[model samples]
Target: MDFPKLNLPPVALRTRMGDRGRTMVWDVLRRRYVTLTAEEWVRQHFVHYLLEACGYPAGLLANEMAVEVGGVRRRCDTVLFAREAARPRLIVEYKAPQVPITQEVFNQIQSYNSVLKVDYLIVSNGLQHYCCRMDYAAQQVTFLRGIPRFEELI
Candidate 1:
């Protein structure tokens, strides 16, 4: 499969048959046959991109991580941790290529932030990506055209 450039290293992926005539693939870290949903496809690719092209340490990244909000369960696409902070430094929400990067996506991450309270937020659809730094004390967010490099996090 053709994938976009990422910031991290290459990962081994294998294809296998899935239910309902779907093709499943193994996501190494997640260790599961994730359904080939459009969004999932974008997500899988971006995870590699973040590591191969963005220089994000693979050990510091988490995929398909779960969190709770308002007594309900929710999943975050990716969570990046910084060693110095001893917690998640960024939370990412990924959409299908067809899904537009809109306020709804931002709002979803914001809701997650209410609980996780990460310092940065990233939303992407494989095609376009939006990143921002959160300033909780000031109640503000600053948008960036793309995800910052690994060094920038420091």
Candidate 2:
């Protein structure tokens, strides 16, 4: 299998026998048999990385959740909520590895944030990841080299 260029390490993909005697691999979270799209592939790895490396609680991480903005429905790649508060804290926007990380990606996430009111935003294309903390009060964004660990956020 050809894997996309990612800054993170390769994930362990498992193969299973399909109904038609074809082989299929369980996707991230081992939830379903999905033909791995470039963005899904990156999201799978990143989800595990967040849980293990960053101490983000897997239970608090929501994937492909829908939110409304200006009466328009939009889906977010990933949203991390505070364990105790159950309030959204971080929003992640994922792109296919081949797709460039551009202002449009940020704008899309920002549009979603208008409703979710998350504190931090992350945009990634597997090969590169960008993180920023939103200063809503000041109407500014501060870029960070990486996302803060769960402990730091708490």
**Among all windows of ten consecutive residues in candidate 2, which has the lowest summed lDDT?**
22-31
After best superposition, candidate 1 residue 3: deviation in angstroms? 11
Off by over 4 Å in 1: 1-13
Q: Which stretches of model 2 miss by more than 4 angstroms?
A: 15-30
Give lDDT per model, in order. Answer: 0.81, 0.83
Residue 100, model 1: Cα distance from true site in angstroms: 1.3
Minimum summed lDDT over a 10-residue window in model 1 is located at: 1-10
In order, how many clashes per candidate? 12, 0
lDDT by residue for model 2 over 43-150, one digit each (tens)?
877887788789898788888888988888888999999877988999999998899999999999999998888889999888889999988889998998787898
